[model samples]
Every structure is written in C-alpha cells, then in structure tokens.
Target: MFDVVVCKKKQEAENIYSFELTLPEQGYLPKFQAGAHIDVEVRPGLIRQYSLCNPAGKTDRYLIAVLNDPASRGGSVGMIEQVLEGQTIRISKPRNLFPLDENTGFTLLLAGGVGITPIIAMAEQLQQLGRDFELHYCGRSRTSMAFIDRLRHSPFAAKVILHCDDGDAKQKLNLDTVFGATPEDSHLYICGPAGFMDYVLGQATDSGWPEARLHREYFSAPDVASADTAGDEEAESFTLRLARSGKELKVAADQSVANVLLDNGIEIPISCEQGICGTCLTSVLEGIPDHRDYFMTAKEHALNNQFTPCCSRSKSSVLVIDL
Candidate 1:
C-alpha cells in the first residue's frame, strides 16, 4: 500500500469533483499508464477503484475524479463529504485491464458521463504521440461535463467533440455516422452507463464492428440475472473439492461458493462481491466453471483455469480448486 496525501480538490462539474494526490515525502509515486486504476481504501474495509486521469508515464502525482453518488455503498460519499485535503490515505498499486492499443491505426474514444476519466488520459497520450484519434464526450448537459474547460484550452481541443442531451438532434451523437465508416484497422474504446453502453455496442455490432475491435470497461458490474430463486428447491447443488487439503465442501443450490466457504471457516479476500473487481480470483484445478464475472476476458474465460468464486459457480458436478 502507498500512502498519499490529498493535496488538492476541486469541484469540476455539477456533482463531479477532481482530486490530486501526492506523496507525503513529495517524491515521485508509482508510474501508471493510461487506463490504469488504483484502489483507494476509504475506511477500514471500504475499498473502491478510481481510474488515474493523469497523462501516461507521469509519476509526480496521481489524479482522480469522483462523482457524488447518493446511491453509493460508501466510497464516493466518504471521499466527497468526509475525506479532507492534507489527510493521508492508502492506495493500491496501479493495475490496468484497459490499456490503450497503440497498434490500432485510428482510435475512436467514446465516453458517457464520468467515464471520461480514462478516455481523457488516452487522448492526452495520443496527442503527445501525434496519433490519429478523436474523443467524443457525452453528458446530460454542459454543466455536468467534467474537464470541459481544460479540454477547450488544451492543444487537443480541435480533436474533441462534445455532445449533450440538451443539444439539437443534429448536434447529438449519431453512432452510425461515427462508426459506419470505421476502417478495419480502427478500434473503439467505450466506458459509461449500462444502458448507454448497450445502445452503443448494439448499434456498432449492427454496423458490422467485430467484438475484438470494441473495448469497454464498466464502472459497476452489470446485474447478473439469475434463474428464478423462487424455485430453489429445483436448483442443482454442487460440490467443491480443495486440492491442497483434499477437503470437500458441499454447496447448496441457493448458496454461493464464497458464502459456503466462509461458513466452513475458509476465508477468501473479496471486494465488490459482484465479481467486477477480480479480488477473489481463484485457480481451478479441475472441472468446468460457469463463467459469470466480467473481470476476465473472453480468452481467459475459455482457458477455464481461473475463476471468481464470489458469484460464479461450477458447471460440472464438482470443481477442484487450488485452495
């Protein structure tokens, strides 16, 4: 864990706030590239991931922006109203699952709401490298957009496009026009609300964009619709076999593997229990897993060697786990 002090905080938009963190010793912190995020430990056990918005290869400080969310479990509210400047906080090392693909000929960045964090970093990198790219930022209105002033005054302003819900139909985003002429070597990166992502992805797919060409990251895990819980009696039960200790645990139909493991005095580090954080990833020694988490890629899911037990279960009758 790296201890960093909150040096500056500013209200960027309506409910969005930007924060600058620096090491207490005033030395360089860890280096992070575009699309990397650091997990900030708000309280004792309340850890939330925030994307690093600073330009790539910079290590002097880390920049993050947070939106005040009333429906938040705790992280956003604590950071917005409870945490103060000069107070030190612990943060995890940088991790990136959404790194920019510099090999792509032309990059199209699509951001909705606060999803501009990573995209902005990518845009900065692209500008510095003189790569061909465009950033389309969308929000409810101009008052709700973060970093608008910065973008407008920056050298990359010419490549930035703003779209608001209050704008005219002609000024609004037309996914078809944006993606219809995309070349085979072009790639698209998206981050935003579930419905917005679905709409954008659906339109892109209908326009013949391949899955590999479209990359995305979700701020929150998509709701995993389970089969009817009312029919628990009809649901199938599974067993977990530990390879290390050779211990077997029976998992009920209505129970998750993590819950059953905890009940049996086995502890597994988990966060977001929704399988979005990849905190509880465990190795699968044997058996097929009914992959459910969005953390792993399609190729990783096909390998079937690792699984997040927090919400995912076994596809076979029994699963052999490393621990």
Candidate 2:
C-alpha cells in the first residue's frame, strides 16, 4: 500500500466526481496498463476498487472517478462526502482484471454512465498505439454524462459516438447499428451498469459474436437469490479442508465461506464481499466450487480450479482449498 495525496477533486457530472491522486513527493508512481484499477482504503475496513481513468503511460498521477450511486454500499458515498482535496489516503498497487487486448485487429469500446472511466483509458492507449478502435459512450442525458467536453475535444474525437436517452431518437444507441457484423479479429469491451451490460452481452451473443471476443467489467454484481433462498439442495452445509494446515471447517447454510474462515482466525483478503472484485479468489485443490461470482468468466468457472470464497461455495460435500 502507498499513501497518495488527493491533489484535486472536480465534479465531472451530476453526482460524479473525479479525483487526481499523486505521490507526496510528486514523483512517478508504479506504471499501470489500461483497464487497471487500484484499491482505495475508503475508511477503516472499507476498501473499494476504482478504475484508472488517466493514460496508462503517465505515472505522475492516477485519476479515478466515482459516482455517488444511490445503491452504493458506502464506497461512493464515503468518497464524495468524506474524502477531500489534499488529503492523503492509502491505496493498493494497480491491478488489472479487465485488461485490454491490444493485438486485436479492431476494438469496440462501450461505456454507460460511470463505466466510461476505464473505457477512456482504453481509448487513450489505443490511440497511443495507433490501433483501430471506436468508442461509444451512452448516458441518460448530456448533463448526466461525465467528461463530455474532454471527449469532444480529444485527439480521437472522430472515433467517438455519443448516445443520450433524453436526446433525439437518432442519437440513441442502436445495438443493431453498433454491431452490424462480427469481425473475425475484432474485440468488444463493455463496462456499465448490470442492465446495460446484460443488454449489450445478449445482443452481441444474438449477433453471433463469440464469447471469447466480448469482454466486460461490472461495477457491482447483479442481484441474485441468496443460498438460503436457493432451496435446500443448494443450501446444504458443506465441509472445507485447508490444504496447507490440513484443518477442516464446516460451512453452514446461513454463513458464507469467508465468514466461516474469518471466524476461525484464517484471514483471506477480501474487498468487495459481493464477489465482484477478485481479491478473495482462492484455488480449489480437490472439489468443485458452486461458483457464484461475476469476477471469473464462464470458461474459468467450468475449470473448477478456483473460486471467490467471499460469495462462492462448494458443490462437493468436502472441498479441499489451497489456503
């Protein structure tokens, strides 16, 4: 972890603010790639991940934007209400779960609302590399969109298309037009609300776009029924075996594996307990995991070698994990 000072805080859009963080000495920090995010210690025991919105190669400062979400579980609220300019905060090194595939022949970038944070970095990287790419930014309205003027005056302005729900029908996003035909070597990267992402993913799938070519990052996990409400078949108690210590623990139906381990004095670093973040991802030594996380792709889940313990449980009666 590093202590970075919040150099500036500016309101970007309606309830959205961008923070510029820099080292105390104003020196270069660790280099990060596009789609990389840092874990900010919002408050004691409250760490939240925010995407790096600044250019990847620029190490002088790191930029992140946070939307004061109504449904936020304290992350955004704390950032907007408590954090102030010139305040020093603790943050983890950059981690990239949503990496950009620069080798693709063509790239399609899609952003909705605050999701534009990572998409902007991707566009900057693509422009720097002289890669062929187009960006489509969608929002509820012009006033609700962040960095509109910046994008409009950017060097790659011509490659960008704006879509507003409250604007003219012609300016609204048409998935059919955005995705006419799937190019063999083209890749699509999407980051947005769960509903927006689901709609885009569904449309892309229906348009014959292979899952391999479609990438996405979700700010929060979609609402899903809990284990208790999943019927007795899925809510059965399970046993967990720690590989290194050879210790065993019982995971009750009403409890999560993370809580069970924590109660036993076994610490597993966890950020987003909802499983949207991959911080608590653990390896499975022997049993299959009933993967309940949005962090890993479907193919990764099918491998059954790893799972996020924060929200995922084991399918096998006794599962061995690499603690």
Candidate 3:
C-alpha cells in the first residue's frame, strides 16, 4: 500500500467528482497501464476500486473520478463526502484486470455514464501510440456527463462520438450502426452499468462478434441470478478443506465461503465482496466451484480451477482449496 494525498478535487458533473492524488514525498508513483485501477481505502474497513483516468504513461499523479451513487453500498458516498483534498489515504498499487490489447490492429472504446474513467486513459494511451481507435461516450444527458469539455478539446477530439439519451434521435446510439460487420483484427472495450453493458454485449454477440474480441468491465455485479443456485430452493452446506493446514471447515447454507473462512481465523484479502473484483480468487485443488462471479470469463469458470470465495459457493460436498 502507498500513502498518497489528494492534491486536488473538482466537481466534474452532477454528483460526480474527480480527485488527483500524488505521493506526499514527491516521488513518482508506480507506472500503470491504460485500463489499470487502484483500490482505495474509503473508510476504516471499506475498500473500493477506482479506475485511473489520467494519461497512462505519466507517473506523477493518479486521477480518479467517483460518482455519488444512490445505490452504492457506501464506497461512492464515502469517497465523495468524506475524502478531502490534502488528506492522506492508503491505496493499493495499480492493477489492470481490463488491459488493452495493444497488438490489435484497431480498437473501439465505449463508455457509458461514469464508466468513461478507464476508457479515457485508454484513449490517451492509444493516441500516444499512434494507434487507430475511436471513442464512443454515451450518457443520460449532456449535463450528466463528466469530462465533456475535456473530451471535446482533447487532441483526439475528432475521434470521439457522443450520444446522449436526451439528444436528437438521429444522434442517439444505434448499436446496429455502431457495430456493423465484425472486423477481423479489431477489438472492442466496453465499461458501464450492468444494463448498458448487457445491451451492448447482447447486440455485439448477436452481430457475430467473437467473445475473445469483446472486453468489458463492470462497476457493480449484475442483477442476474447466480448460475450456482439458479433453480435450487436453497444453497447446500459444503466442506472446505485447507490444503496447507489440513483443516476442514463447515460452510453453512446461509453463510459465504469467505465469511466461514474468516470465522475460522483464515482471512483472505477481499475487496468488492459482491464478486465483481478478483481480489479473493483462490485456486481449487479438488472438487468443483459453483462459480458466481463476473470477474472470470465463462471459459475460466468452465475449468473450475479458481473461484471468488467471497460470494462463490461449492458444488461438491468436500472441496479442497489451495490456501
């Protein structure tokens, strides 16, 4: 963890604020990539991940934008209301779960609402690399969008296309027109709310876009029911065996694997307990994991080698995990 101070803060849009964080001692921060994010300690025991929206190559400071979401479990509220400029806070080094495929011939960056955070960094990096890419930003309205003026005046402004729901119908996003025939060597990166992402992904899929070419990051877990207990009346009790300690713990039907482990004095690092973050992903040595996380792809879940213990349960009665 690094101790950084919020150097500056500005209201970007309605209920959205941007914070610039810099190391107190004046040293460069660890270099981060385009789609990297850092975990911030919002409160005593509350941690939340926010994407780096600033230019990627620059290491002097990290910029993050937060929206005061009404449905937030507390992260957004704490970040917007509690964190102040010049306040020192703890944050993890940048980690990139949604990294850009630099080798792709062309890129299509899409952002919805506050999901523009990571896409902004990606646009900067792509421009610096002289790569072919276009950015599509969609919002409810012009006033609700963050970084509108910044994007309009950016060097790559010509490559940006804005679509607002309240705008003219012709200017609205048409998924069919935006995504035509799939390009062989082009990739698509999308980030936004669950419904927005689902709509975009569903359209892309129906258009014959390959799963490998479609990339996305979710700010919150979707409302879809977990495949683990889709039709089941209730979750079944399971046994978790620690490989290193040879200790077995009973996971009750009403309890999560993470909480059960914590109750047994076994704590695993966890952030975003909703299963959107892969912080607590653990390898399964034996038995199958009833995967419930959006972090891992379906291919990874098919292997059943690792699972997010925070919200994922087990299919097998006796499951062994690598501690």
Candidate 4:
C-alpha cells in the first residue's frame, strides 16, 4: 500500500534537498526507526527508496534528502526537478533492515556524501538517549556536505566530525586512526559509494572488527565487475520448479529468473532488478541457490531458504522455489 503526501522542499546543502512530507489530508504518519527507508513513487512505474532522516520515533512528518544526480534513472531527477514544493506524491511504508542496537559499548556512525541521511538520524537518536556515539561525515568538499549548518548548531555538534578532501589532507578522515582504536564492544555503521564502503570496510576488517560489530547499508550495489563477468557466461540451461504449483520451467543462464517467469506469464513483484532491493525475494523450498544479492546478511545466506530471483541463480541444476 502507498500513502499520498504533499512535500515541501527544504534546502540542506549544495544540490542536496530535503523534503518534509505530510499526508495530503494532514495527519500523523507511520512511526519509523532511525535507519528506515520508504519507497517513493517518482512516476508511473519508477520508484526509489530513500532513508528517513527525521529523528527516530517521530511521526509528525517524514524527512528525506535527495541529491540531484544527472546520472540517476529518473527517480532523483523526478523528485528534484519535477516534484516541486506543494506537489503530491505516493510513497510506501517504512522498511528497515538496518537499525541501531543500543546495547553496544559505543557506536560509530560513518557516512559518505549523501549517505549522511540515515547516519544523522541515528546520531540524533543516540544523543537523545544519552548514548556513547560519534558521527564522522565525509564529503569531497565542505560545500558538498549536507546538514552542516544544522549539525553545527545542534547540541550534539561536539560529537560530530566533518572531513572534506578539498581541505587539509591531514584533516581528512583517517580510517586507520578511527578503526585502529575502536573498542571491542563498539558497533560500526557505514553507508556510502561502493569504493568508499569498500575502503572503510576493508580497513575495519584489517583492524579486527568482527562481522557482528560491523553494519552497512548501500545506496547502490557494490561494484561487482567480476560478478558481472561471471554472470554473463554462456547460457547454462536449468530447471525452475515451483513447489506450490508443481510446475517446472526452463531458465537459461543468459536469462534472469524474473525475465523467464514474465515470459511464461508468471509475474513477480520486483524492484531494483539488480538485486540490491529484496522486493523479489522468494523462499527456496529445495536445492542450493547462487546468492547474488546484497540484500541478505551472511547469516541469512547460511540458512539457504530464500533467494532473490531478480538476479540470483541456482547453484544446482534445478531449484525448487516456493512461489
């Protein structure tokens, strides 16, 4: 289900714009956690998920920031250019796979570029609860950083660190210094571009940060050049058995399950067909799956009971799926 709302634009920084959304009829919206995101319907068939940046547990109005990217697939373009203030749009309910765990000894919030949206919200919540936390916000330039003014004036400004590459090189974010001295019971959260995420996560791992202590959410899928090459190999025909329907369908390696299903008159709800979103996730009744999605954690992969058909394939010759 979707809720129709009227949005008013609030400029945050440079090309970054925050929209305060309220129901067209004006009433309390659904309550959401710090890391929750809502899927906004930008156009007839185009939808994009954006993190709710407002304080956690706040139901007054949902706030989302969007950076005007010319390279976007019409979602950001539509929101920044087409959807003006006072215009109405539809958005999905909040969904959160990334959330804050308050039981940690300390919290490290690392954000790159527009990734600050969710991390900022997490910082605000942590501050309100009087928790031990620090936020490191990085951008190419000070002018490019969003919410800079707001954070500077906030009561928690002392807990915030700003790093800009255009500034002094020594002042830039030093992953080694940050991760090297991390407490054993601390939890780290990161969000950013593929390269930025890789660098932070790779160094954190080298610093002995356990898998359980590290959490990340990607606005885009990690750069998988090798995976793309492997996925494009010559077609290897396989069978897809629908456990519920007792039907079997042939799936060519060159064709994704979603495409094959669509051709066979079987429709499945899907978004971010690149496997970044979990909208097309389906249960695996039998057989092993080649997990190609970034939506699931390592623990979920170990269960082997679900897979995203939009991009993931079968490891076995046949995959029995619960359709």
Candidate 5:
C-alpha cells in the first residue's frame, strides 16, 4: 500500500463523494488502461476498490469517487462519510480488470448508480479515440447521480443517455431493446447494483446476445447479493487446505470459505473481499468451486479449475487452495 494525500474533494450527489489524491510524482505510478480501478488503504488492514474515473492523458495522480451506501459494510461508509479532507491513505497500484477491447467497433455501456465510474472513464477514452459508442446511465434520481455534469459537458455528450427513475415515468433501463437493436458487432459493458446488474445480464442472455459480447463488473462478492439465489439458500460443509501452511480449515455452514481463510492468517490480496475484483483469486487444485464472481472468463474457469476465493465454495469435501 502506498500513501496518497487527499488533494481535493467534491460532493457529486447527496452521498456521492469525489476525491483526488496526490501521489509522489517522481516514480512511475502504474500505467493503467481505461476501466481500471485502484484499491485504497482506508485504515490498517482495510482496503476498498474504487474505479478510476479520470481519463488517460497525464500521469499525475488518480481521481476516484465513492458513494455512501447506508446498508454497505463499514468500508465504503468510512471512505465516504468519515474520511477527512486532507488525510492520506494507503493505495494499491491501479489494476485493469475491465479493459476496453482494442477492436471494439461500437460499444454499449450500461451503468446503474455509482457503477457509472468506470463506464465514464471508458466514455472519456472513447471520446479521445473517436470511437462509436452509446452510454446508458440509470440512477435513482438526477440529484442522486454523480459526475453527471462532467459527462454532459463531454464532446461525445450526445451519445450518452441518462435515465432517472424518479423523473422519468419510463424509468427502467430497457436492456433487451438496447441489446436487441444494437449492431451485431457491438460489445456491451454493464456495472451497477446487484438487482440492476442481474436484470441486465439475465435479459441480455435471455435475448440471445453472445456471452463474449456482454461484460459486467461487481463491487462485492456475488454471493452477498445472491445469498437468496439457488443453492445458496442451503449451507453446505466443506474443508479447505492451505498448501503452503499445510493447515486444513473447516468451513462451517454459517461461514464463507473466505472468513475461514482470513481467520487462519493467509494473505489473500482482496479488494472487494466479496469476490468482485479478482484480486483474491486462488488456484483450485481440486473440487468444483461454486463460482460466484463476475471475474471469471467462461473458458478460464472450465479450462483450468480457477476460482475467486472471496465468494466461492467447494462442492467436494476437501478443497485445496494455493494462496
């Protein structure tokens, strides 16, 4: 974790806050492509991933935004509500898991609430490169949206569609019509709340859009949102073995495998801690992981038994994790 001072702050919405951090300019700040996010060290041993909303041009510092979710785990609440203006926080170098495809002809961008962060970054990049793309941003209300002014002022501003449920009677995001009418070569990107994301993805899949063409990002482990999903309703028992430590940990019916690993002092690089970012991805030598993350490429999980440790569980009794 690197120390970065909060250079500036702004309130984008009622609880949506933006922060610009000042990092040392001497060394190279990791060069991140569009759609990258950085993990900020809030307090000792606590890190949260915020998407880089700034466009690429200068290599000065990183700009991030955080929305205070009242129902969220304390991490986001602390970052947004409790963090002082000038204080510094440890930050991980930028990582790009949601990179734009180089050959994208025309892209469809969908964002719900704060999920607009990275999608806005992609719009900035697309504007610079003169790419053909359309962005659909859905929010609870106009007053609740972040970065709306910046987006409206962009050169490619006409390409953006902002949907506010409170103001518009036709408030819902019509993902099916959006995907159905889009060009065959179009690639789709989505980010947002779990219900919004699931609806968009499920509709897209049900509409017959190719899986490769649809992409999405999550801020937490999928199971957290999908706890009521099929199979998750019933807790199952499993055992995990740490290869390096030669210790076996039992997963209780009530606890996730991640909590068990953490209780044992295993250093798994986790950002979302909910299996959203693939940072805590662990190698699966055995057992079928109940893959519950948006991180995996269909081929990557099936071709090799890879799983995100943050939200996955084992179907087999003995699951060995390579930390």
Candidate 6:
C-alpha cells in the first residue's frame, strides 16, 4: 500500500472533483507515463482504479478526477459523499494497460463522457511531444464535461472537437469521416460507455477498418444486465478444488464459480468483481474456463489456461483450481 496526501481539490463540474495528491518528501516517487491508473483503497475492502490525468512534470504529485455517479453501485457515490479536503488515502502504484505507441501517422481519439479521463492524459502527452492527433469528446453538454478549461488551451486545441448532444445546433464531429475508408496508417483509440463504444466499433467494422488499427476501452464492466451475455448462461454445473484449501466446492449454474470458492474459504484476489480487472487471474489445471472478462486475449485464455473466476465459469465438469 502506498500513501498519498491530498494536496488540492477542484470542482470541474457540478458533481465532479479533480484531486491532486502528492507524495511525501521521500527521495523519489514511482514515475508513471501517460495513460496510467492507480488503484485507490477507498474503503476497508473496496478499491477502485482511477486514471492519472496530470502530466509527468509533477514529480511529487499525482492527479485524478472523480465524477459522482448517483447511479454507481460502488465508489463514485461514496467518494462524492465521503471524501474531504486534505484527506489521506492509500493507492497502488500506477499500472498502464492503455498506452500510446510510437507513430508519426495521424491518431484519432474518441472519448465518451467521463471516459475522457485517461485519454486526456494521452492528449496532453502527445501535445508536448508534438505528435499529430485529434480528439473528439462527446458529452450531453459542456456543463457536465470536465477539464473544459485545460482542454481549450491544449496545443492541439484546434484539433479537439467537442460534440455536444444537447441541441448544439450542429454535431461538432462525425466518426464516419474518421473511420470510413481511413488511411492504412491511421490508428483509432476510444474510451467510453458500453453503448457508445459498441456503436463506434460497429461502424468501424462496417467501414472495413482492420481490427488491428482499432482500439477501445470500456469504462464499466459488462456484468450489468448486458444483452450480449446469455440468460440461460451455464449448461452444466461443476466442482472446483482449491489448491490452497485442498477442499472441493460445488458450483451451480445459477451461482458464480468465484462465489463458491470464496464461500469455501479460499481467497482469490479480486477487484471489479464485474470482470474488468485481471486481479483474480488463476491457473486452471484440468478444466476449460468459460472465459468472460475483457482483460485477457483469446490466445492468452487458450494457451495460458488462466481464468478470472469472478465472472468466468467452468465449462468442464471437474477442474482443479490453482487458487
């Protein structure tokens, strides 16, 4: 667990707060490139990952912004209600899964609502490095979007297009021009809500853009009543033997495999039990894991035989869990 002091807080929108936290006068802090996020322990057992939006200029501080999602089942609501100025918090070192690769070709970035957090950092980095990129930020209106002030002054400000949905007279941007018959050197990046991401991805696919040229990240996990997931999900039940406990647990089709293992007193590291994180990753010795999470590639799931049980189930009847 790493410690951070809340150095500053600013309200970016009605319910959104941008927080700047700094390390102690300790010799040096872990340096993080753009598109990195830190897992903050907001409560006794709950930890949430928030992206670092500030540039690498501040060696002493890390920046994060939080939106109070009244509909959020977890941290957002609590972080909005509970946190105060000058509070101390524990955070994990930064981890980057969404990173900017070296390229001279024009880059297209799409951000939907609060998903702009990480992409904002990438844009700032690109601007400093004098890279060619364009960002499309979509929101209901300017009132709900964060960082309007900073984004306006970005070196790539002219390239930043704002698409406001609340009767902006005209749509500020369109994805068809960005993806349809795009150049071979063009690379696209997106981060947004599920519906928005799905639509953009579908359009890109229809445009015949190579899957390798398109990249996206979902802000929320897919376990929340998704139509893509099956209702009559599991066909058969199975037994999972924990390597740590040397005990077997029965899992029913109605229950998640992770729950049964946890009920049997075997602890598997988990965050975002919704299957967004790879924290619960475990090796499967004998059975096929019905892969569900977005973190693992198809090849990784097949070749590595590792599973994320929080949302994954066993396809085989009897499997040995490495725990």
The 0-to-1 C-alpha lDDT of every candidate, in the order given, reads 0.85, 0.92, 0.91, 0.85, 0.80, 0.76
Candidate number of the best lDDT? 2
Identify the runs in model 5 with alpha carbons over 4 angstroms from their true place: 24-28, 170-172, 221-233, 243-247, 297-304
Two-way lDDT contest, 4 vs 6, winner: 4
lDDT of 6 at 107: 77
Write the residue-wise lDDT of candidate 4 on 1-323 in tens digits: 56665567977878888899888785788888889899898888888888999898888799999988766778788888888888878888898878899777799999999999999999998988889988999999988889898789888999888999898977699988887666778999988776798788888888888888889887877656444336657446789999989999998868899898999889998767766768889999998888878778778888999999888888889999998
Question: What TM-score does prediction 6 earn?
Answer: 0.88
Itemize residue pairs with steric clashes in candidate 6: none
lDDT, candidate 1, 109-130, per-residue tens: 9999889999999999988888
Model 2, poorest ten-residue lDDT window? 224-233
Mark the 10 consecutive residues where model 6 has the least summed lDDT.
Answer: 223-232
| Over 4 Å off, model 4 | 227-229
1-323, model 6: which lDDT tens digit per residue?
Answer: 77787778788876788888877555455788877788888877888878888885555788888888766867877666676668888888888777776474777888888878888888888888888888889888889889988999877789888888885556655776656544667777888777787788788778776777777666576535545345436346788877766778888878887778777776777777766657788888777777777666545767647888888777677777786
Error of 3 at 79 (Å): 0.7
Instruction: Determine the backbone clash count of candidate 6.
Output: 0
Quote the positional error of residue 242 for candidate 1 in Å. 2.0
> Residues 173-249, candidate 5, lDDT per residue (tens digit)?
67666777799888989888877887888888787778899888877544344553244557688888877677889
Q: Could you give the candidate ranking by lDDT, starting with the highest?
A: 2, 3, 1, 4, 5, 6
User: What lDDT is reached at residue 212 by model 6?
Assistant: 73
Clashes of 5: 1
Candidate 2 — what's its lDDT?
0.92
